[model samples]
Target: MEMQKEPVGDLQLHQVLRMNEGDGDNSYSNNSLLQKKVILKAKPILQETIVQLYSKSFPECITMADMGCSSGPNTFLPIWEVLEAIDESSRKLNRKPPILQVFLNDLPGNDFNSIFRSLPSFHKKLEEEMGGEFGPCFIAAMPGNFYRRLFPPRSLHFVHSSYTLQWFSEVLEIPLNKGNIYLAKTSPPGVHKAYLNQYEKDFTAFLRSRSEEMIPGGCMVLTIYGRDENSDSSAKHSPTIWDFFGMMLNDMELEVTTPENHKLSM
Candidate 1:
């Protein structure tokens, strides 16, 4: 049987430019400039939360995975920070650091070259911090569609995905009509419904897959694009950088297609 072709959209294209720097030297710098502030502010909060949660359950869990770990040195920054926090916490409790199996996942087309280029530096950082006594840290790439299987059953102890789950394999388009007033606009009812439906399906699959591969008490830390605390369900657009990317995608001439629509379970 032939494998299904994964869907692509404006977000993927933008990522290509950001990762490949096809536009020129300044393209990535410009993009990073725009994202720097938000990245700095959010990294600590996300890192703290994931570390705290995982430490509470698996105080010595060394095996962890970062799904959708696109190519970038910055991508691993927060992950390492979280690991360091876990190490410190473990030492305080008089326990040896757990052996870490760091699995970095992404699409087959992702720029693994760049990721590999940064691996040595990451290892050196680990060596500098842990010296010879640091727990063994092994890094490997798991290339495939995350919507599908990515690891052996019941293998992972903790999982982390950031700003990635909001992106469905495809963007669902909502046609403008008399019944749908929010079509083509941000937070349009139709668009919101479409996005949520896709997210629900994908997220459920993600949870199920992880559940199978994760220990009963395994922890999952996901920082996704979401509506504001005060926003109602009627508001469709994410109140995060994803919203900006979505608008940019629309402007870049990418067509959004709505597949099967369904309600999502939180």
Candidate 2:
């Protein structure tokens, strides 16, 4: 969707960018199988990083931020993985479990209320698994843009993002990519360049902001959906599922969009 350039009146990217949210049947919390799979694939990395960080610092409290944590079942998956890792590491080292301060971050538009309502069961499960012996863990909502700094300097111990960085901070018009939402066989050279340039700019901002927020020995685990540069950008062998979704979006655009109200709205 095309957006007006930055002026106060222009819609902010954070205001517009988000997954379907709520507790309904088709909401992100209910129908996020792909996102759940992403969390599983990154589980090993998250566990390893948690162990390493805990062993190195052994801080009384571990402050973790799950960036782009859209509200859903997948939002807390990393928390479980890391907690198990820390529990194991602590036992092996003869140390007590560290207290956890979990921050679930997303744009202001995310359905944090649904996540909040579901917290009791999550904490209950934690108690069921570790009993009262494990250090108390707390989860809080952090609403903001990841492209900007959201924490005090050197405050975060661990950071994680899954299928988040692929989205651009702003959805600008790419007139060159006619008939395609992304780079495809029919796309012109400029279309690919525009996408790559935007990705590089947004990623640089993310890294720079994160570097300041994370401590010296802090670690991060990130998983992105992407296609190989050399491979054909078709649905058959592509690693990402955007090809199918993009086609669906294009159809919707054609069906409903008009010259005056072309931009999509939820």
Candidate 3:
């Protein structure tokens, strides 16, 4: 696999950020309802795209990828949805479904083991759900940042991502904004420009990389958080959330510096 650059500026995201793993309360498996909802909403698009793909040309096998496929029960939802789309189209067309080759891509640190553990259930569910109608299905993991090349040219026919690209490759080393973990309405124009530049670069890289890997006529369905149409680029959804965080931090700093707290520490 070709080495990819950090998704956030120079910061290596694979090292620092990952969905919480395992079956604990914090695990992505348990807490990914919103992500799942995004995937569910994309189903109609997926179905339409697959139908068009079949109409144009029927490949012997369908190459599908779920980029940023974090380790969790939710990881295989895209695979299942895509397969269902293909199956439905095949039925409509009175044609046999194509073999399904799925690539689950995520950062190297993602809990692939958890995903692997869930594979048996995934397979069993597919069999029970589709039986002989479903063609041979092969699922594999590609551990790398999607901002870089992860597959060979013309290797994929479909790609999907949900609620992932909003994260930049890294945090800006220079804190342009005074008291925000992410872009906020209070951020200056320069800070906003810096973030927009990072986003454009990262999103461009993501598209370029995918273009190299996907065949002509391939389809990509992705969901990302965006500012409201009426809102400016700097106006993120949670403007006050960060300000509250900043206030809490300031209070903690004052508490630590107080005479009573200082004396107790000494």
Candidate 4:
């Protein structure tokens, strides 16, 4: 895996930052249990929404996209859940299940090749699991920043995003959040303000871009990375797995900068 560089100039995070790729132990595919849980938790909402959409319009084909679909087994989780829901609905309503046109979207730096390579197996599994009664699925990749428009205007019928919205397109170069990596209790007021400003700006852009791309009556579901609404901001911002990761990074930095280590390097 390539080391992530701290943003130095005008370069955006989307241009440089990439998720751990390939199916190695350290790769995102092997270590995204948290994200997997999030996706499954939102299953009910996705099912209900799909059922409603199908009831309203008996379209021959349904076009949907899953933003931030990193490579691995989880890559097809949304597709499976969606097709299953539609199949159930179709059986109940005595209607034909619409064929799916899936767009899996992420940053250009994402592991799109790995996803493409597994397409054969994925299609085979879908066919085996669902059998001939199910409609076919056509999947394609859309590698780009979701904060910008990714699809043609008024083309997509549904959008699903899990654990993606909180990541800003560009890293802020503000000289703040020094002691901590993220907005923690130690983060000063200025640091907090800067992060909040960036969050608002990025989220607004995301909404605007998606709104323009989705067709009329289209719906979306997102699992945003955020603190609990009931939590007190004055207190610690509530701990996440990334907080422990920040601790490990800080320890590594201290080790690298110790007098013995620094002098030996010199």
Candidate 5:
């Protein structure tokens, strides 16, 4: 029997997730001025667009899903923002907010305890804010990978994923004896090709699954990391918080796990 490949260690994975702090990292909060202008600015616009689409296409829709939701204070902010917009728009149509069914999805290893701990407060705030007129809010947790499938067929009205999807299942291959950092800088062609290959595969699967599970004309809003206009084609890695975590991995002497044998369950 073939031995199964060990899963990527959490510490190393965390590094990759937080690597955006390095110099030249446009993902840094300091870079937030510009990043905020181009990327952060697009979020509200996209949410509004989604709300408008829903109002026109399915004004009664209240079932939403936040895919790749990590547990934290930040996780629910965007969802709340979008919902608020939707609620306001519904008000214009003399319609009450539809009974909301929210599904929060993440990997099996995600910090669900923290998520549940924060949920009651989230619900309470919404209820109090809406007073007695609020529609029923049903929030449930769905633990699984996002690269495959997450929702019941034809169930969701709105789907959202933010700041995820830049992650590949594993580190890209670097030339031997060139050192990780050097290979990452000089061998741009190979690294980007690898990243794009994985992105296309994962992204295609993501869209396909969502298409199957979403009602026809249901809206989707996704916010992801991408290269700037000036990014050099030869640079092996883009700057982001995940790169900060990668630096930490180097300091801790951790090896990045390869992606070949690891089957991600979306």
Candidate 6:
């Protein structure tokens, strides 16, 4: 897929960028096993946050939000983890479990219908495990970019996002960044500056939006891919996969290059 320079508000482009539906070859449901691993890796952090919240004050109702929840099996993992932590804490404290209100968020173009299809089984399992202990639970979908607010002010108690915020909401295009895409070694200084500026802009917006929505004792667990600051080579860091992709593109261009074509293309 070609990377677009457009921002997240480009709804038409978002529709194209969204994951494939069903369990097909390119479907997120089939391809998100790695995402599941990321969620698992962050489980301990999530548990600790929940424990802290329970220790501080056990609210009568818990409001949780999972951002960038791509439609798939991994979509429900955060909710399950939260429920487990809440259950354990409640048992240890000998207190009644709180009513739960969970919100699942993603871009408007996400496969929400596909996600909804799996809810029947999700609710069934939750009921079986949490019957008579916890109050009635409600789950709903909130569709939009996480760089902006989705919930009401002081409504959310916890927010979770796994391996998602590493992506900038949009890439700033520079004429100097001609052949290569996304911060290549050969890119000019301006390109690097532009990327950093965009990163700050988007991330700042994300944090500010969450701040408005979360309660006083709220907590958020975010998992993102960050490069080692001491590493000079961009290819050796977290974007190694993208580096390989750029190499493949360069190779394909070389294969099509010839004396006559080279002069014409230039």
lDDT of the candidates, in the order given: 0.63, 0.84, 0.81, 0.85, 0.65, 0.82
**Per-residue alpha-carbon lDDT of candidate 1 for residues 1-266, written as tens digits (9 for 90 to 100):** 11123546655743442244323564332355433444456666756765566567654545778887766555675567666776776677677777777888877667677777778888898889877687777888887667767788988877877667766655454434222222223344655576568778988888888888876667677777565535553466444554555556554433333232222221
Span of 10 residues, lowest total lDDT, candidate 6 = 1-10
Residue 226 CA error for candidate 6 (Å)?
1.4
lDDT of 2: 0.84
Model 2, 90-160: lDDT tens digits are 99999999999999999998888888888999999999998889998999989988988999999999999
Clashing pairs in 3: 7-169, 8-169, 8-170
lDDT of each residue in 1-266, candidate 5, tens digit only: 11123657744654345323322545233343442343346667766866677577655547888886666555566667766776777787777777777788876666666667778898889878866686767778887667777777998888877777766555444324222442245344665465567778878888898999988778888888776535665554556554565566575553333353234422
TM-score (all chains, Cα) for each model:
0.69, 0.86, 0.88, 0.89, 0.70, 0.87
Q: Relative to the unseen true structure, what is the C-alpha lDDT of residue 23 in candidate 4, on a scale of 0 to 100? A: 92
Ranking by TM-score: 4, 3, 6, 2, 5, 1
Error of 4 at 31 (Å): 0.6
Shift of residue 161 alpha carbon in model 4, Å: 0.2
- Candidate 5 or 4, higher TM-score: 4
Q: Cα deviation of 65 in candidate 4 (Å)?
A: 0.9
N/CA/C clash count, model 6: 0
For model 6, what is the error of residue 227's alpha carbon versus the real structure, in angstroms, after optimal superposition?
A: 0.7
List ranges where model 5 is wrong by over 4 Å: 1-43, 58-61, 170-177, 181-183, 229-266
By the TM-score metric, which is better: model 1 or model 3? 3
Worst 10 residues of 2 by lDDT: 1-10
lDDT, residue 60, candidate 6: 91
**Stretch of 10 with least lDDT, candidate 1:** 257-266
The parts of candidate 1 lying over 4 Å away from their true place are 1-61, 171-173, 177-188, 229-266
Clashing pairs in 2: none
Range of the 10 consecutive residues with the lowest summed lDDT in candidate 5 = 174-183
Best by lDDT: 4
Task: Compute the lDDT of residue 51 as modeled in candidate 3.
Answer: 75
Better candidate by TM-score, 3 or 6:
3
Q: Report the lDDT tens digits of candidate 4 across residue range 1-266.
A: 11234764444556667789999999999999999998899999988988888888878899999999989989988888899888899999988789999999988889999999999998888889878778899999998888888888999889999998888777675545665777677676777787789999989999999999988898898888787635676574566776888888888988898999989999
